[model samples]
Target: MAKDNRIQMLPAEWRASTTLSGVYALRMLGMFLVLPVLALYAAGLPGAADNKALVGLAMGMYGLTQALMQLPLGMASDRFGRKKVIYFGLIVFAAGSFMAAAADTLEMLVAARAVQGAGAVSAAVTALLADLTRDGVRTRAMSMVGLSIGLTFSVSLVLAPILTELVGVPGLFALTGVLTVISIGVVAWATPNPQISKLHEDAEAQPARMGEVLRDSRLLGYDFGIFALHASQMALFTALPFALVDLGWDKVQHWKVYLPATVIGLIAMVPLVIVGETRNKLKQVFLLGIACVAAAQIVLFAGLGSLWSIGLCLAVYFIGFNVLEASLPSMVSKTAPSDLKGTAMGVYNTMQSVGLFSGGAVGGLLFQHYGFSGVFGFCTALLLLWLLVAACAPAPQPVKNLGFAVPPAWQGRQEPLRQRLSAVAGIEAVRFSSDGQTVYIKALQEGFDQTAAEQIISGAN
Candidate 1:
């Protein structure tokens, strides 16, 4: 049979990817909806009126629990099955949301947020996505998930304040619980179960390889990058709403600023990302993003007393935030060893969760003592540090993963096949599954010679 080289996803693949992306997006939406208004809402609660630290903890408690449970829940999926784990996680998340909605005190809200984070089903969702898609199209499937997250975040920023005005923070939590329950239904009925659920190293983390992924200096740099990026984001939010209020904008009207800022930032992000990926100038683009974020913080620290000035500063910040958010995982994929990509992502995500926790906790403390200047100043310093770390790290090679089935005859001839494929132009590194069923290649993204590689695979050379 001739190979089907078309890049379009099969109908089933589309269904799987779309539904899974929806499930992931819903879960993320639940978290994001609170971010824009959580600090302000928490401030009004008992035991929080005088304690910005407690409010910050309420904002960040989710991250702390999420960081702790993310890997364990993912590993649980391996043992108990993906759907089972995902269902369990969604239920726990919904329970937490309800708990948060009913809470009357900041302390109770903090515990509820911790419960919310305990769901930690991101890895399982990704693993299930990997299970449902073919190797050739897995990257596209993954991109859908990433796109959903970005869109969810943007929508949340615009909607959170408006929603808070209508139903208040408790209503938001209750709504999240309702949406999460709906997501559970989507998982059971909409998402197709995979016929086989074995591990895919390119998509699922492996415990045995954790040390190797951790020790790589390049991966560590990207890890720190994600950490700083999210930390800065959480830290910024801890004080931004209050700042807007002080500047004479009602909390609900703040969306006017966010709407335009987010739109412009997204528009600006497109050209930079395209140039970076296609032109092989990713490092330069990345550093520029960090600089933009740092500059925004510096502006805030220098004092933006008017809504217009604050809005302009946010536009710059979002440009950097969106670019870094989109590019960091791609950089991680390029930097990690071909087979250890999953493990590297696992560690990278853990660091992100930790950053979220730290930022909220620390930002709140700083804001309580030193006000807006302290919060922005701390964020600026962190980003500058990350920029330096990223600068010293080696530039990432522009490569993408390609997987092909191992022919029966080639199963026992791993070394020879590796050498043959590695000799092919554009193919940089080759790795085989332990059972020799699949061969994964790290090939140049721009001009991978798929036909040549396929011909070699079929013994037609």
Candidate 2:
């Protein structure tokens, strides 16, 4: 293949990836829009005033349900269909959002959040993306989904305070319900249903390979790190709003702090990501990110009473978060054997979702008794654990995930084809489906002989 022979999405793939990303973003928007303002609003609600712990549980409930359902929903997609699962999940999510909008009590809100989290379709969406796109363009398509979530978070931070001022928190939840309902229509009308769906090794998890990926020491390190990352995230927000209010910032003015911190954090994140990928310093970058997160917590602990200090701490946290979020998945792919990639990701995603719930639950309980400093102390401990584990983990070699077309005649010849590709010096791992129409590979990017691999595969046919 020529260096300039760029991989491109077909019109259908382009629409599908974009629309699915939008759908995912809608769901995330509902979740994120609540984060910045909910702590403030919940404090005024029933049960929340007497016991702030109720506020934490309400805040984190979605994550608990999301974690519990992610894998099962993904598996369900295989049995029923991707679109069917997605439509059902979206409906459930919308219903939950509306229920939340209607809730007058913290208990009611918590229940609604649980229902919202139950609509976990993340794995299903990834599987559908794999079904829709060829290997050459799949990563880009997936990145679009990830990027959508990050963008959604930023937009929600800005929009939430404005929305809350206009419609109130319940109104914001109602808007989430409405947007999600619209997104369901988008999923139906815009996303092309996959003709055939299977356990996509590159895109979705396989239960059979769980043991291998889970037992690996390095992958476990990343999993623990992600868990800590999200846990700290949920805990921080559980207390941040109150801390800001105490610092004399009004609820509506909260966006002023969040807007700049998020924008600049994302800006600072870009360069760190580049250095990690281009400079082959991923482990060092990962450690540095962990250190920043710890530093952010310490800053929060020390400066909760100061507006500028809180702003700076939030900015640092987001910068670290963006880098780790991008780096961890790539490292997981690089570390796992090709066939078990999805399984590894399945566990990783589970850890992330569960961390949200844990953070909310634990952060709330800690804050209720020990106050803001206690919450920060706990999060600081998590960051410390992540730092220790990440330090011992090996630096990842520079590897990239690549997809190739396999002809129908080669369907039964995976062993020979694997041997042929493995002989290519840069290829690290090769995996083909039972049907053998698509091949996924991890290879050293520096000297990968794409031309030779293409010719040999074409010659096979």
Candidate 3:
């Protein structure tokens, strides 16, 4: 295909990707809206007096529960159907939201948040995305979902202080519950169900592929990169709001700092990632990002006394954060066997949750005992370690996506067609479902020719 021809419009499945992602945004808004404001409000509650540690515990406990349940829920969706599992998860999330909304003390909030986290549905949502779209468009669709989450995080950060002042944490929880209910209706009524199949029986037959994924030196490096990235993120937030307070910025004006910085960070992140993936300099880009992260932590530690410094640190932090987030997923996709992509993502997400819980809990303790300097020190160390690990990871294979139209004869020759394609050189894997009328192939570089493959189909007919 010519360069111009290679660029395609966003496929139709993007609509469902956007809608499902909106549901995630709604859920996250409830969770993140309180992050900046929670510690301040907890001080006023009856049992929250001087126990900032407890506040930290409450903030991060949800992650622990979320981590534990992600994969199991996803596997369950395979058995019960995606929509059914999604609805069940949403109800669980709504119940947790209500519990948190009703809580009068810090301890109650902690328990309630755990319940909310327990409704882990990321895997289910992912499976739903896969079920609703063709494989060719699925990556782009997932990108939309990712974009939604990032945008939601930005919106929540800007809105959190203002919303917190007006309705408080409890009110935010109620709003989340209402949005979740709406999400249920959307899932049931609006989304179209795409056909599903076991496309990679060969990969499944070799159960050791999973062990390979787990033990793969390169993926492990990226896995550690994710854990460190999130851990630092959790630790930093433990003190960021208070640090800004000391610098004379009020809660409501937090958006003033966050909004422009987020824009700047996003602007810087996109180009670097494009270069990294297109040029095959993934490890280099990932390491550079970690270096920037460490620098941000250092800046945070050195300059807690001024608002300008805080803003600069935040700008640096977000730039690094956004780049790593985008690059990591692409790396995983490029490196993972197309067959076990879901399972690899499942494990990656679980690590992220583990980081979240650990970050909050460890950050709290560090702050309570060692103060702000300690939090920065902890986070800085994490970034440094991540940088080292990322530097050592093997480079990912260059990706070139191929799309093919099904031949008219494919109607009756599904198995034969697949068998013929499987024997072709350079083709790594093929998925052909007669009912779905689609074929997905992952190929080796410079081996398979699309025109030649097309001719074979024509001759077979």
Most accurate candidate by TM-score:
1
Each model's lDDT? 0.91, 0.87, 0.75
List TM-scores for all candidates, in order: 0.98, 0.97, 0.87
In model 2, state the lDDT of residue 209: 76
Clash counts per candidate, in order, are: 0, 0, 0
State which candidate, 1 or 3, has the greater TM-score.
Answer: 1
Off by over 4 Å in 2: 1-5
lDDT of 2 at 67: 90
Per-residue lDDT over 422-451 for candidate 3, one digit per residue giving the tens place of the 0 to 100 score: 777777777643343555566655556555
What pairs collide in candidate 2? none
Output the lDDT of residue 128, model 3. 80
Lowest summed lDDT window (length 10), candidate 1:
1-10
- The CA lDDT at 242 in model 3 is 76
Ranking by lDDT: 1, 2, 3
lDDT of 3 at 249: 75
Model 3 stretches with alpha carbons more than 4 Å out:
1-14, 194-209, 400-440, 443-448, 453-461
Candidate 3 local accuracy as lDDT? Answer: 0.75
**lDDT string, candidate 1, 1-461, tens digits:** 12234767888899999999999999999999999899988999998867998888899989999999999999999889999999999999999999999999999999999999999999999999998988778878999999999999999999999999999989999999999999999989988999998788888889888999989899989999999999989999999999988888888887898999999889999999999999999999999999999999989999967888899999999999999999899999988877788889999999999999999999999999999999999999999999899889888998877777788878799999999998998998999866687788888977777788988888887
